[model samples]
Target: MSSEEAAPLLCAGIATFNALKKSGAEAGDMVVVQGIGGLGHLALQYARKMGFRVVAVGRGADIAEDALRLGAHVYIDSNKEDAVARLQSLGGARAIVTMISDIEAIAALMGALAPQGRLVLLGAGKNPLPVSAGYLVRGERSILGSITGTPFENERALDFSVLAGVRPRLETVPLERAAEAVARMKSGQATFRMVLTMTEKSHARP
Candidate 1:
């Protein structure tokens, strides 16, 4: 991987990788990756390679194709359907790796967990996340936050990524065009991960 490809792995890759490791889900178990942006996309790939049945939850149909391509066995468009019901229909997820910061949206997904399920949170929202005590106690479900891992863990993630062919979808721009890249990112027009390179060459990918 080039510098651009390696950049996201250092941050989003290690973050999602650590989150999934904390999930306590075993192989063949159901795992849902909520949100299909930078972190979520990498989570999907990691979850699938880890041998879990991957489900990707995101807004809009536009992301469905990419989600499926990324390794999700099923892609749930939250805007068109009830994600909880959909997840339930497939037998509740053993672990849910969430990458979005919408507190209410995150709260609503608690019901989609199977017994002893774990909801690994990677996104941090300003508002408090509302979760029911009964829900956790009854099903033995739990929620935990995860950030990037230790340096050794990061190395493990990188090794796994290389062995499993897991990579971030990147849109690279030269340092001279950093302002343009920032604008695109702010507008949500950036495809996935955007890297600002010191070199004059760009590495924009599909």
Candidate 2:
């Protein structure tokens, strides 16, 4: 893998990998990835490769195709359909891994989890997460936060990526254009990830 490929694995890759590991979801179980952007995209690939039935939930129809291409068995458009209802209809998710930080939005997804299922959080929002006791007590569903891994775990994530052919979809920009890249990322215009390369010219690849 080139630097562009390896770069994301170190950050987004490890984060998602660790989140999945902590999710308590087994192979053949249903796992939902919400957000379908930088972190969620990689999570879908990892979950599929790990043998989970992957479900992707995103806000637009535009992302549906890419979500499927990235290894999701089902893509739920949150804009047009009720994501919680759709997920519940599928027998609920064994684990729902999300990078979205909207606490209200996160609260809404709790209903989609199967009994004892977990909602693994990878995004950090400013406000407190408003979770009702009934949601946790009645179904035994739980929420947890996950961050990047240690050096050894990072190596493991990389090794797994290589063995499973998992790679981040990336757009590379010259180091000189880093500010432009940052601007695009901040504006949510970046397709997924933007890598700044020291090379004179930069390119994009799958």
Candidate 3:
């Protein structure tokens, strides 16, 4: 993979990986990753390498095969199947590393947690994630949020990425086309990641 492809490891990858590490997810734990974009892909790989049984949740079947290839033991296509029910059938997730800002989506998956399971939020959203007091009390479940961590954790994410051969699939564009890339990303048109590469010509442009 190119440097452009590896750029997200500095941000998205580290955030998700750190969330998983802090989620109390042990070997043989059932871990679910919500979303299959930049962060979720790496999350799936990291979860698998860390010895957890990985389940990848995405909106559709578009990412199912890739999620499986990335080491997800199960793929939950939220559009076709009920994510909560599917996870429940597997005895619920020990930890869910959610990478989406969709509050409803987050709310929908909270019930899929096992007792003492946590929902770790790596993506920020303007809306609040509402949880019932009874819900938390009943299962002893909790929600935690993680941003990119200290330099050491960042370095660890990179080192682990290298060691585990976890990599992001990328779509590279010249720096001059950053706006186009951003639009594509915002539109959810990027099949995976969009990376911007710097060049002398792009640097020289006003």
Using lDDT as the yardstick, the better of models 2 and 3 is 2
User: What are the per-model numbers of colliding residue pairs?
Assistant: 0, 0, 0
- Model 2 TM-score (2 dp): 0.97
Which regions of candidate 1 are displaced past 4 Å? none
Which candidate would rank higher by TM-score, 2 or 3?
2
User: What Cα-based lDDT does every candidate model obtain?
Assistant: 0.91, 0.93, 0.87
Per-residue lDDT over 94-187 for candidate 1, one digit per residue giving the tens place of the 0 to 100 score: 9999999998888898789999999998888899988889989999999899988889998899899999999899898998999999999889
lDDT of 2 by residue, 157-182 (tens): 99999999999998999999999999
Report the Cα lDDT for residue 167, model 1.
Answer: 86
> Clashes in model 2: which pairs?
none
Flag the better candidate by lDDT, 1 or 2. Answer: 2
The true-versus-predicted C-alpha distance at residue 93 of model 1, in Å, is: 0.8
Assess the local accuracy of residue 76 in candidate 1 as a C-alpha lDDT between 0 and 100: 92
Off by over 4 Å in 2: none
Give the per-residue Cα lDDT of candidate 3 at 190: 75
Clash pairs, model 3 backbone = none
What is residue 97's positional error in candidate 2, in angstroms?
Answer: 0.5
Q: How do the candidates rank by TM-score, highest first?
A: 2, 1, 3
Q: How well is each residue in 79-123 modelled by candidate 3, as lDDT tens digits?
A: 999999999999999999999999999999999999999999987
